[model samples]
Target chain A: MSPLVEFRSVERTYPSRQGPLHVIRDVSFTIERGGILAVVGESGCGKTTTGKIAAGLVDPSRGTVLFDGENISGFKGPELSRFRRRVQLIHQDPYSSLNPVRTVYQTLAAPLKRFRLVKNRTELLHKVRELLLTVDLTPPDDYLYKYPHQLSGGQRQRVAVARALTVNPDFIIADESVSMVDVSIRSSLLNMLLRLNQELGVAFLFITHDLSVARYFSWRGKTAVMYLGRIVEYGPTPEVTRLSAHPYSRALVASLPVSDPRVARLRAQDDEVGSPDVPSIQNIPPGCAFHPRCPLYMAGSCDRDVPELMGMRESESLHQVACPVVLTR
Target chain B: MSIRSDSAPPASVDGATLMSVRDLSVVYRVGNRLVRALSNVSFDVMPGRALALIGESGSGKSTLGSALTRLLPRTAEITSGSITFNGKEGRVQLLDLSSEELRRFRWRDCAVVSQMAMNAFNPVMTIQDHFEDTAAAHGLRDKAKIHDKAYELMETVHLDAKRVLPSYPHQLSGGMRQRVLIALSLLLSPELVILDEPTTALDALSQRAIIKLLRRLRQQLGLTMIFISHDLSLAAELADDVATMYAGQIVEYTDVFSLFDKPKHPYSVGLIGAIPDLSADGASLVSIPGSPPDLVSLPSGCRFHPRCPLSDDKCERELPLLVETEPGQKVACFHWKDAQTLKGSDAFEGRNS
Candidate 1:
């Protein structure tokens, strides 16, 4: 079967004061049906832009975002509406994405009504409650009539999830969905997404700057590591985090402060983590954009030519990395 | 620094206690209701060690930061307790100090780098003007002296002094603004530095950079730091000691290493469990079940009982006082021993329901 979403060598750029800012370049990936693909990177790495491109919100300057077999950009009118209904984007901030004046019922019901999913008031109410239940906001009566301000941050985020689920989308682009929620309640939200993925077979393009969250949330899924608008590593989540091939990916993984202070203390002492100030998009360094900060940076080859994503030698797993040094090794 | 009971010696034998807080309780008046923002929160900051206050939102972590620097708003009042700073001159009572004295004592004694460093600066003023004002307030009236110090600070923080001095707050990036704020906090070379969620607004790269800078500054300057953060991992990375707060009370206090390895409080265990472990992929996170209790009308017994898995009748009716369960760990949980033995599956079962 065709993948749920596919990015065929996507590139995105915007006209800027410095020049044409290449926010995303030569990125390609696929999300299979019921599979999760976590795109991990720091800010300005084009992870958000990639999510937008997948959602058809931002038209890529080059290449195409394909939903199933067809280009998402080609969809129009009824097709566009269908695509919109089938693909949902869960925003980062729960406070701003939801309307303050709308009741939880209205927020969920509007989408059900817009998509003509329910016929009458009774069905609408039933469907709304069911949507809330699906997102684990139990009993439903306690929260149906409450305004956004009446609920807590986690509750607000659940309502946001319910709003997205009202359309019964097959694919979700959760752009840092749990980043804004309190860390204590973040797991519950992530578990809710996991349940949806398991039970409903919903595919996800989880975008986050946090590698640990990506590792846990997309355990059975694949991970794509982006840096300066390029996918430096793409592979199974566990392998990518544990044995990441690219220097940048290793740096990111090393940068994470483990809960164990023993390990964290050791990591803190290690000077080989994190990149230098990320070069601006207008002036992305030639060759490997990460060469400046890489510990094993090859002076001549790495600085002269950009490396293509290649499979690591002697590794049977489908782990791919974009470092020429690693590839040569 | 081993954990000691509440009855332990108030001051270290070596006089290493830079600041000692005892039974520090703070309350806020929201309209007519009295909100108990902090309840008997006490800890000590050693001369050059870092103390991390880790907790979720509404857990009074930030309130503790504000209270330490006497930056609490008009609504909040410190009803009881004493905060004694062992300054170079002598022991000084922070709570009893007059407003005028506080003005003199604020940055010169202990400084605060609050969250949202961008908003901390005035939009209309250049970065240099802010530095000059701070210098003037501290009685450094000479323009040349202020300029020299400001340049020195910029150099320390790795910002281009020439480019950053004339620029307004908005002209610099979030990381640059945060660096400037840290530099400003260090302008007086205060013994204690209170950093409240210093890098929450920045991206991962910038967060790493700022944290590295802070760690370096602390070492180079021998600064005693109080890092207030909700991120347990970061707390582990930055602080030497960890104090876990819930609702308005401190539930756990110990050295960072001991706290992470053998967490005695259920809340601490739950907090550690909630974090996604990088080593263990697809690990099921065990988040604490219920939300924190309402401060105004708290639970009958322990504030954390409602959400605690090991809570029982005693925990529900009688408030659990902090006890040094071990040499270096103080925990207030009634059944922390059972919690420590109970594996993740047994402890977290039905808790997420």
Candidate 2:
């Protein structure tokens, strides 16, 4: 079966005062039906732009995006509406994404009503309660009348998820969904998303800067590591996080602080990147965007040639990297 | 690590405490209700040690930081507490200091680097102007001398001083602004520095840079610090001692090694279990069952009892005080002995499993 969504050499650029800013370039990936693909990167790395492109919310300047084997740019009217309903985007900030004046029932029921998913008030109420229950907000009656201001951050996020599910979406783009919630409640939210994927067959494009979170959410799927708007590493989640081949991925994984003090103390001190500053998106370094900060950077090749994503020799599970220095070694 | 000439003496030499808090309780008046922001919170900061206050939002970690520096908001009142600081002159009670003395004590003795580095600086003023204004407030008016010191400190924090000192705050990136804030915090060379979520706003790579810089500063300067953060991994990376706060109380206080290796409080265990571990393959994460309680109307007995898995009638009826479970470890839970046997996953197994 064809993948649910595919990006063919996608490139997006936004006009700025200092010429055109290359937000994302040569980004290509696929999200299979009911499969999870997490895009991991730092700020201004174009992960959000990539998500918007996948959701049909933004147009790519240079490449084609295929949804269900059809080019998204050609979709129009009813077909575009259908695509929009099928692919939903959940934003990062629950506090701002939700309407403060709308109650939980109203927030979830609006989408259902507008999509003609429910006939009357009773059906709408029942559907809203079911949506809340599906997201694990138990005793849905207790939350139906509460406003966004009355709910906690976790509850607000769950309500946002329930609203996204009101239209019966086949794919969800969760953009940093769990980052704002408290750590004590973050795992439960991730577990809820996983449950939805397992029970309802919903695919996810989970975007996060946290490597550990991406690894946890997409353990059985794939991870794409983005640096300065390019995918430097792509592979199975565990391989990308634990045994990464690219210099950027390796440095990111190494620099993460382990929860155990003993392990943290024993962490190798050689993972330091050359510079602490990430170049502005408008002024990204030429060649490999990460070469200026890569620790294993070669002088001539790293500064002159841009490396393409290539498969690793030793990895059997389709692990690919974009660093020539590490690839040739 | 060669000690700098201006660095303070090693903390372990005399084993003297730098700052001590006794029964500190702060309450904020919200409309018609009195919200207890902090309750009987107490801890000690050694001269060279870094203590991490770990908790979620509304846990009063920030309030406690404000209380220590006597910078609490107008609505907040210190109902009961004493903050004692051992400085260059002698022992001084922070709460009893006059307004003028508190002004001197804040920057000269203790500096606070808050979480919002984006809003910490004046937008119109250059980085040099900020340094000049700060130094001028502390009676250091020599511009050339200040410029030289600022240049040295900026280099210490690994910034390009030539480009940064003349640029306004908006010209610098988030990471650069944060590093400048750290540099400014060290301008006075205060004995104690309080940082609230120093790296919470930066990206992962930038966070690593700040952590490494902080470690280097501690080694070279023997700086004493109390950092308020919600990230457990950061606590493990930077803290010498870890204090876990839950609903305005210290649920667990122990060395960093002990807190992560063998936590003795149920909340601490739950929090540790909730963090996703990258190194451990297929490790299941378990989140706590409920949200933090409302401060205005708290549950009876222990504040954490409502969400704790091991809570019993004894835990519901009477409040538990901080008691020594080990040589230096302290826990404020009635079932701490039972909590000792529970791993992070075991504590919240059925909830998320």
C-alpha lDDT (0 to 100) for residue B302 of candidate 2: 86
Tens digits of per-residue lDDT for model 2 on B31-91? 9898988988877888899999999999999999999999999999988767889878688
- Fnat measured on candidate 2: 0.77
C-alpha lDDT score of every prediction, in listed order:
0.85, 0.89
Give the lDDT of residue B176 in candidate 2.
94
The stretch of ten residues in a row with the least summed lDDT in candidate 2 chain B is B1-10
Residue-level lDDT tens digits of model 1 in B118-217: 7899999999999999988999889998899999999999899999999999878788899999989988888888899987888666777887898898
Per-model tally of clashing residue pairs: 0, 0
Q: lDDT by residue for model 1 over A1-329, one digit each (tens)?
A: 88888999999999988879999999998889999999999878999999999999999999988998899898999999999999999999999999999999999999898889999999999998888889877778888999998887888999999998989999999999999877778987898899999999999999999988999888899999999999999988888888888888877876776788777656644437434466666678899998887778878888889989888887899899999888887
DockQ of 1: 0.60
TM-score of chain A of 2: 0.98
Runs of candidate 1 with Cα error greater than 4 angstroms are: A268-275, A299-301, B1-16, B124-128, B143-155, B158-168
Error of 2 at B32 (Å): 0.8
Which number leads on lDDT?
2
Instruction: Look at candidate 2 and give me any clashing residue pairs.
Output: none
What's the C-alpha lDDT at position A185 in model 2?
82
- DockQ per candidate: 0.60, 0.75
